[model samples]
Target chain A: MTDVLVVADHRRGDLRDVSYELVTAGRELADETGGDLHVAVISGTVDEFADKLNREGVDAVHTVDYGEEFNHGVYTQATTQLYDELAPQYVLTPNSVNGLDYAPAVANELDLPIVTDTVALETDGETLTATREMYGGKVETTTELEGPAVVTIRGAEWPAAEGTGDAAIEAFDADIDEDALGTTVNGFEEVGGGDVDISEADVLVSVGRGIEEEENLEIIEELADALDATVSASRPIVDNGWLPKNRQVGQSGKVVTPDVYIAIGISGAVQHVAGMKGSDTIVAINTDPNAPIMDIADYAITDDLFDVVPALTEEFH
Target chain B: MKILVTVKEVATVEDEFEIEGTEIADQYLGADLNEWDDYAVEEAVQLQEAGIADEVVTVTIGPEDCEQTIRQALAKGADRAIRVWDDALEGVDLLDVEAKTEILRGVVEEEDPDLVLSGVQSGDDSWGATGVSLAEDLGFEWAAVVNHLEHDLEDGIASVRRELEGGVEELTDVELPAVLTIQTGINEPRYASLRGIRQAQRKELDVQSLADVGVDEGVVDSDLELTDMYEPESESDVTVWEGSAEETAGELGDLLRDKGVAP
Candidate 1:
C-alpha cells in the first residue's frame, strides 16, 4: 500500500481553486496505490482550509499553522517533515507560482526526483509515468520514474474534488528554523489598471506574435474599432511594449470572459487560454491550422490574419 | 558584485513538422537563445551598467554547438561564458532536474558569485525548477517569476515584484548572495549591437568537461526517463470557414451580426 500526500494551496484568506484539483489528483493516485490519501494545509486559517479540503477521498488532514502568507522556507520545512513522518509514496502539489517556489526545494531536501507541470499521471506501484507538454504545448511526452518522487500538476487539468467528508483533522507542529529563512514577503499589489479595462468589455479583439511586427497592430485596432470591441493582446505584444500591461490577457495579466473574443494571429498557449477559455464565443484567425487556439475556438479562419482581419474589418464598416 | 546568468540554447519547432520516435525531426528544428533568458541577460547587463555589478558571467549546460547562443548573451553585454559538457551527456534523451541541479551546483561552487540570474523556465523542457533547485543545493535564497527588480540593493537586500496569476504582484525582499528566476516584460531586451557583436568574438568562452567542473560521470544517470512523445490531439470541434480571405471574413461578420455583438 503506497500512500499519497497532497499539499493544498491558498492565497490571501481564500483557498485557490487548484487546491481542490490537487485533491482530485491525489484521490485518483491513492485509488491506484490502494493507500490512504493525506492532505496538508499550511499557514493562514489552517482550520478553515482543512475543513474545506476535507473532500470525499481524503483520509486525513494535517494543518501546520506557520505564517500568514506563503514562505518557501516554512513550506519546504513542513512538507519535508510530513514526508518523514508519513513516508508516503508520492508528494503532490499544484504547479502554480507559489508551488514553483517551494516544490523543487522540498524535493531537493528529501533527495527525491521531481517532475513538474504534469498534466496526467499513472502509476503501477513502482514506476510512475507522468504526461506533460513541451515546446510551448506543441507536443506531449510521457516520462517514467521510479517511486517516492515529487510531482506538480498543472491547473484545470483535473476536476476539483467535491462533497463533504468525515476525515480526521489534526495539527502537526513543525519546527521552523527562523535563522535559516532568507526571503521576506513585503506585500502584494494589483497592477494593470489603465484607461481601459478589457475585462468589462463585451467584445475583445486580441492579437499575438503572429502579427509579425508592432506596426501590424494597427489592423487589429481598426478591426476592434469597427466592431465596437476593446483591444487586448497576448503576452508577447505587451512584453514588446506594443500594448499596455492592462490590455494583456493571460495568467499574469487579466482574465477576460467577453461575449466575443476574436483571437487574431494568436496561438493560444496554455497560459493565454487560461484567461479567455471562459469567453462565451471564441473566434481564431491564424495561418497555422494546428495552432492551439483552434482547439477552443467556436469558429476560425485558417488564413493570414493580415488579409482576413482587414476584410473582416471592412464587413463591420 | 559579481553576477552569473544561466543561459540555454533551446530547440524551436516549425508549425508543420514530424515526430521521429521520441524526438521532433531535426530538419524542422531551429536553435535560439531562450526568450526569458534574454530578459535576464538584459537585467544583468543593466545592473552592470548601473555600476552595481562589477562583472557579469554566463554559464550554460550544453554542447559546443550552443556556443553561438552563448555568444548572443556575450554580445548583449555579458562579460564571459562557461560551457559545461561531456561525452557522457551526449546520448541522454532528457536531462532531468536532479542531474541539471548537480551539474549547475558544480558551476556555482566554482564561481562563488554575489548573485545568480536565470530564466523562469526554458523554452523547450519548461521544467521551471533549476533556479530554485540550485539555490536549495547551495543554501542560497531564491525568488521566482520576478518582473520588477529594484536596482538599488540596500542593506544587501534585493526587492522584487513576483508576477502572480490574475494581475497580482507580490513584493518580496531576498537577502543577497541569492538566485532570481526572471520573468518576461521585466525589461526590453536590447538587440545586440553591431559593435557589441564584433566585440563578442573576442570575449573569453571556456569549455569544460564534467571532470573539469568536479562533477562525476554518474550524474548522467537521470531518474526520469522519456518513454513516449506525440503531438497533443486537437480536441477542437471548431467550425472552420474555408474560402478566400473576403469570404471567410464575411462569414465571421455575419456571425457577429447574428449574435448581436456587432452593428
Candidate 2:
C-alpha cells in the first residue's frame, strides 16, 4: 500500500480552508492506492485544529507543534524532517501565497518535481499523477511525478469531504535546530491594517487598463455602488495610481475566489485569471469578444464597455 | 535606492508552443521576456520614475540566448543589465530558475540592493515559486504574490498588500532589503517604446560567466533530474457555449456540476 502525506496549510491558529481540501485529496490518493491518509500539520498547537479536521476519510493526523506562526526556514526544515521520516509517495499542499513561498525550496531540496496550481491528483497503484492548469487557464497539464512527489493543490479545486474518521494522532520527534533558520519572524503583520481590502469582497467589480484614466474610475465605482460590490482592478489600474494595490486581482496581486467576479475592460491575462478563476460566478464586460476573460466568464457583454457599463449601471440602479 | 529586477527569457507566452505527448518542441517559436517577469521589470522602472529608487538594474540567467530578454529590460529604461549564460542549465534543476537565482544571489551580494523583485511566476515552466526560494537562499525577508509595495528600505521596513481569498491583506512594516514577488495586479507590464527601444539598443550590458563566480563552467547541483517534458493530454471534450448568457450559464452550471466542480 502507498502512503499519502498532506501538509496541513494553516494561518494564525486557524486552519485554512484549503487544508480540508487537501484532506479530501489525501483521502482520494489513499483510497486509490490502498493506503491510509497521513496528514502532517505544522503549528504551535496542532490539537486546537484536530477536532475541526476530524473526518471519516483520513486515516490519521501527524501534528507538529512548532510555534504559533509560520517561518519559511523553520517550516521548510520542519517539513523536510517529516518527509525524511515518512517518505510519502505523494505530498499535497495548498497553492496559496504562504504555501507558494516555501513549497519550492522544499521541492528543490528534496530533489522532487512538483506540479503547482493543481486542480486534481489521481493515483494508479503507486504512481501518483497531478493535474494543473497551465497557460494561466487555457490548458490543463498532467504530469507523473518522479520520486517522492510534491504538489500544491489549487484551493477549492476539490470539495471538502464531509466524512468523519477518528484514525489517530501521532507526534514525532524531528530535530529542528533554530540555528538552521536564517530568517525569523520578529512579528506577524496583517497586510491591510484595517482598510476594506477587495480580496475579502464577496463580489468584485474590477477594471483593467482599458479604462484609460484614473479619474474615470468613478464609472466603475458607480457600477460597484449599484451592485453593493467592491471595486477591484488589474495591475495596470493599480500601478497607474487609479486604484490602490489592495484592489488589484491577479497572480502578482491576489488570489481571490469571490462569489461573483465582474470584469470591465480587462483583457484577461493568465495572471489575472489565475487569481480569480475560483470565483463561483464570473461576468466579463469587455469590447473584445476574444478577450481571455470572456473564455472563463459565465456572462459576457461583447460591446463597447463605455456603452455597456453605463447601461448596466443604470439597469442596476 | 538600488532595485534589482530579475526576469527570464522564455518562449513567447502566446507562441504556438507544441507539446508532443510528453515532450515539447519550440519550432518556429518566438522568444520574449516572460510576462510575469515583465511585470517585475515594469515595477522597477516605475519605482525609478517615482523617485522611490535611484536606479534599476536587471539581471537574467539562462542560456547565452537569454541576453535578448535582458536587452529588452534595458530598453524599458533599466539602468543596466546582467546576463549569466550557461548552456548546462537545460533541465529544471540546472537551468532557468535555479541558475537565474544563483546568479541573482551573487549580484545581490555584490550590489547590496535595497530591494529585490521578481515576477510571481515565469511562463517557461509556470513555476510560481522562485521569489520565495530566492528569499530563503539569500536569507532575505520575503513576501509572495504581493499586489502592492510601499516602503522605505532605509528604514529597514516595507509595506505590501497581499491579495487573499475574498479580501486584501495589508502586510505592513516588513523588514527591508526584502524580496517581493509581484503578481499581475501590481503593475501593468509596460511595452517597449520607440525612443526607449532605440536607446536600449545602445545600452551596455554586463555578461558574466559561471567562471566569474569561482564555480568555473558548471556549479549547479541539479537536485531534480528532468524525466520528461511533454504536451498535456486533453481532459475532456470541449463544449463551446454559443447561446444567450442565461442559456450559457444554465448549460455551464449543468456541465460543471455534472463534472462535480460546481456546488
Candidate 3:
C-alpha cells in the first residue's frame, strides 16, 4: 500500500494549527492511495511534540529531535531520511515560511517533484493532482504531478484534524551536513512589538488598498473604536507602512476568524480571502460593485467608503 | 560582485476574464514587468548604487516581446539584460514550475553571479517556486519572502528578514553567492527617467535561445500541464444595501445589533 507522510510545522513549543490541517489532508490522500498516514515532527523535544500529534487517522508519528528552532538544513536532512525509509507516495507540508524553506531543498535532494501553495489535492490511483490558484485567486488551475511528489498545503483549506489516538511514535536520526547549513536564524523580532494578535479578535474592521492615504486610516480607526473592534488591514496597507504587520489580515498576514469581519475599501484578493474567509460574518464597503470583495461579502455597500464609513461610525456611536 | 535579478512579463486583466476552452481569453492589457519583480530590480539597483555590488544583471525567460520588460529594468539601472527564449518554448505551460526552474538554472549557470534575486512569486502564475528551486539546483544558500535585506560584502554574508505568515518576522543570515526571493514592499521601485530610458534603448539587450543556454531540445518539457483554466465559483450571497450613507449606516448598525455583532 502507498503511504503518505505529513511534515508537521511547529514554532516555539506549540504545534501550528496547520499541522492538524496537514493531517486532515494527509488522511484524505492516504485514503485515496489506500495507504497509511504518517506524520513527521522535527524538534528538540520530539516526544512532547509527537504526543500532541497523536490524532485520529494517523497511523504513525515519526519524531526527529534536532535543534530547538526550525533549521532548514536539519529539516531537509531529517525529512529526506524519513522519506527514504517510508517511501511514501506523497509528502505534505504546510506552505508557511518555515516549510517553504526546507521543502524545496528536500524535494531537490530527493529529485522528487514538488508543488507549492496547493489549495486542493486529489489522486487517481498513483497519479496525484493538485489545485492552486493563480493571479490573485482570479484563476484556478488544476495540475497533475508526473510522479511521487512533495506538496505544500495552504492553511484553512483543509479542516484541522481532530480527536486523539494512540499512534506509534518512532524516533529517526539523520546525518545532517554542517557544510550545507549556510543560513542561520539569529532570532525573531516582532514587527509590531507582539502587542496585537488580530487572530483572536472577535470583530475586525479591516481596510485595504482602497484606503487611499495613510491619513484616511483615522476614520477607519474611529469606526473601529466606536464598535470596540480591532483594526486590521490587507497586505497593501501593511506594506505601505500605514499599518503594523501584526494588524494585517491575509495569506501572508494573520488568518483571523473573527465573529464579524468588516472589509472597508478592500478589494478581496484571493490571498486576503484565504486568511479571513472563515469569519462568520463579512461586510464589504467599496465603491465598485464588481469588486471581488463584494462577491463574498454578506453585506455589501457599493458606495465610497469615505461616505459610508463616517456614517457607520456615527451610527455606532 | 555581480548581482542577477530575474524579471517576468505578465498580463494584467482588470475586468472579468473569460475562459475560452483550455485557455484564458486574450483580452488583457499589453504585458508589463511583473509587479513583484520590480521590487527585486529596485533592491538590486540599490545594492549597486550603494557599492555593495559591482554590477546588476537582469534576465527573463519569455517570448521576444519580453525584451520590452527587460528594457524597463535596464532603465531602472540594471547593468545588462539577457532574454532566454526559444521557438520550442512557445507551447510549454507557464505554470510548470519544474520547466521554469530548469530554464532559470540554465541562466544562473551562464551568469555565475555572486548574488541572484527574484520576486517572491510571479504575478501571473504565482507558483513561487522557480527561484527557490533554482537555488537548490545551484547549491546556494537561499531565503524566500525576504522583505528586508542587507549584505556584508567584506564578510561575504547577507542578512535578511522574512515576511512570514501570521505577521511573524524571522531574521536569518546566509553566506553570500546566495539566492534571495524578494517580497513586495521591500522598497519603492524608481520610475524610468527620460534619459535613463534613452540610455536603456542604446544598451545591449542580448537574446539567448534555449539551445544557447545549454537546454537540450525537449529537455525543458513540463511535468505539469494545465488541463483547464476558469474563474472560481463565487460563494458570495451579498445583499447590496442602497440609500444615503447615513441611512445605510443606520440600517447596517441595526442589522449588526440584530445579528449580535455589536454592543
Candidate 4:
C-alpha cells in the first residue's frame, strides 16, 4: 500500500494546531491511496504530542523524544530515519515557519520532489494534484507530480482531526550524528511588546501598501484618531519601518479579533487576512474593486484612500 | 569572507489580469527584483561595508531579460553577478526546488563562497524552499526566515534571529559556509544611487550556460507540472458603496457609526 507519513509541528511546549490538520490531510491522502496514515512527532513532549495527534483517522503514531524545542538538524535526521523505516509514499508537514527550515533539506536529502504551502491535495495513487497559490494569492494553480513526494500544507486548510484513535505508539530511536549538526539555537525572545498592544483594541484602522509614502500615513492616523480607534497596518508598513511590529496585523504579527477592522489600501493577502479575518466587522477602502480584501469585507468603499479617508474622518469629527 | 547572494526577478501581476491557459498573459505581467531578495542583497552589502565580508557576489537563474533586475542588485552594492541560463530552461513552466538546488549547487561548487544569502521565498512562486535545499546539496548549514543578523562573525559563527509565528524570534548561531534565507524588515534596503547604477554597468555580470555551470541539460527537466491556473472565486457577499470618494466615505462612516464602532 502507498502509506502516508505526516510530521507533527510543535513549538515551545504546546503542539501547533496544524499538527492535527496534518493528520486530517494525511488521512485524506491515505484514504485516496488505499494506505495507512502514520504520524511522526519529533521533539518537545513527543509522547504528549503523539497522544494528542492520535485522532480517529490516524493508523499509527511515531514519537522521537530528541529535544525540548525544534532543531532542524534533529528534525531532518529523525524524519529521514522515520521515512526509511516506514517507506511511505508521501511525507506531509505543515508549511509553517519551522517547517520551512527543514522540509527543503529533507526533500533534498531524500532526492524527492517537494511542493509547499499546498491548500488542497488529491491523488489517484499514481499522481498527486496539489492546489497552491502564486503571485501572493492572486491566482490559484494546480501542480501535478508523480511518485513519492514531500508536501507541506497551508495552515487552516483542512479541519483538525477529532476523536481519539486506538493506535499503537512507537518510540523511534533516531541515530543523530552530533558532529553533523552545524547550528545552535540559543533561545527565543518574544517581540512586539512596547507602548501599545493592538490585540486588545476594539477598532483598528489598518493601512497597507497603497498609502505609498510614509508621509501619507498621516491621513490614516487622522482617521484612526477621529474614530478613537487604534492604528494598525499590514506587513509592508511595518517592514518599511513606518509602523512598529506591535501595530502590525498578520500571521507573524498578533492575531486581532477586534470589533471592527478598517482596511485602507490593503489587498488583504492571505497572511494579512489570517490575523484579522475573525473580526466582527471588516471595511475596506481601496481603488481596486477586485482586491482580495473586498472578498472578506462586510462593507467596501472602492475609492482612493487619500480622498475617502479624510472625508470619513470628517464624518467622525 | 566572501558572501554570495541569490537574486531573482519575480513577475508581478496587474490588479486586473487574464489567465491564458496556465499562465498570466504577458501584457498583464511586469518584472521586478523579488522583494525579499532586496533585503538579502542589503544584508550582504552591509556585511561588506562593515568590513566583515570582503566580497559580495550575486547569482541569479534567469534569462537575459532579468539582467536589468540583476543590475539593480549590483547597483545597490553587490560587487559582481553570475547569471545562469540555458536554452533548455526556456520552456520549463515551473522550476522545481530540486532543479533550482542542482543549478545553484553547481554555482556554489564553482564559487565556493564562505556564506550564501537568499530570500526566504520569491514573490511569484513563493515556494520558499530553494535556499535550504541548496544548502543540503552543498553540505552546508542553513537558517530560514532570519530577521536580525549580527554583523560580527566571531569564531566563524554567524548569529541571527529567526522570526517565527506570533512575534517570537529564535536566536541561533550557525557555523561558516552556511545559507541564511533573509526575511523582510531585516534591514532597510537602500535604493540605487545614480553613480552606483552607472558603475553597475561596468561591473562584471558573467552569463553562463547550464554546461558552463557544470550542470547537465537534463537538470531543467522538473518533475512538477503546473496543470491549471485561475483566479480564486470570491466567497463574500459584500455590499459595495459605489459613488464618488466622498459618497463612499459617507457610507463607510454611516456603517461604522451604526455598528457602534466609531464615535
Which DockQ values do the candidates obtain, in the order shown?
Answer: 0.57, 0.21, 0.62, 0.57
Model 1 chain A, poorest ten-residue lDDT window? A191-200
On a 0 to 100 scale, what is the lDDT of residue B140 in model 2? 79
Candidate 3 backbone collisions, by pair: none
Residue-by-residue lDDT tens digits, candidate 1, B187-257: 98999999999999999999999999899999989889999999887658999999999999999998998
Using DockQ as the measure, the top candidate is 3
Docking verdict class for candidate 1: medium
Off by over 4 Å in 4: A194-232, A236-243, A250-281, A285-292, A300-317, B240-263
Per residue, candidate 2 scores C-alpha lDDT tens digits across B125-222 of: 67787777677667677777776776344466667765444343535445667888887656666778898888887887887766654344444653
Q: Which scores higher on TM-score, 1 or 2? A: 1
Stretches off by above 4 angstroms in model 2 are A170-176, A179-242, A258-269, A284-293, A299-317, B1-5, B15-28, B35-58, B74-82, B87-117, B134-143, B146-263
Candidate 3: residue B188 lDDT (0-100): 88
Error (Å) of candidate 1 at residue A137 is 0.8
Provide the TM-score for each candidate, comma-separated: 0.87, 0.74, 0.92, 0.87
Name the docking class for model 3: medium
> How far is B76's C-alpha from truth in model 4 (Å)?
1.3
* Top-down DockQ ranking: 3, 4, 1, 2
Tens digit of per-residue lDDT, candidate 3, span A158-258: 99888997789998777777788888989887777475778878889999988899999999999999999899999989877888878978755778888
Error of 1 at A300 (Å): 3.3
Deviation in Å, model 4, residue A25 alpha carbon: 1.0
Query: Which whole-number lDDT from 0 to 100 does residue B133 have in model 1?
Result: 92
Name the DockQ score for candidate 4: 0.57
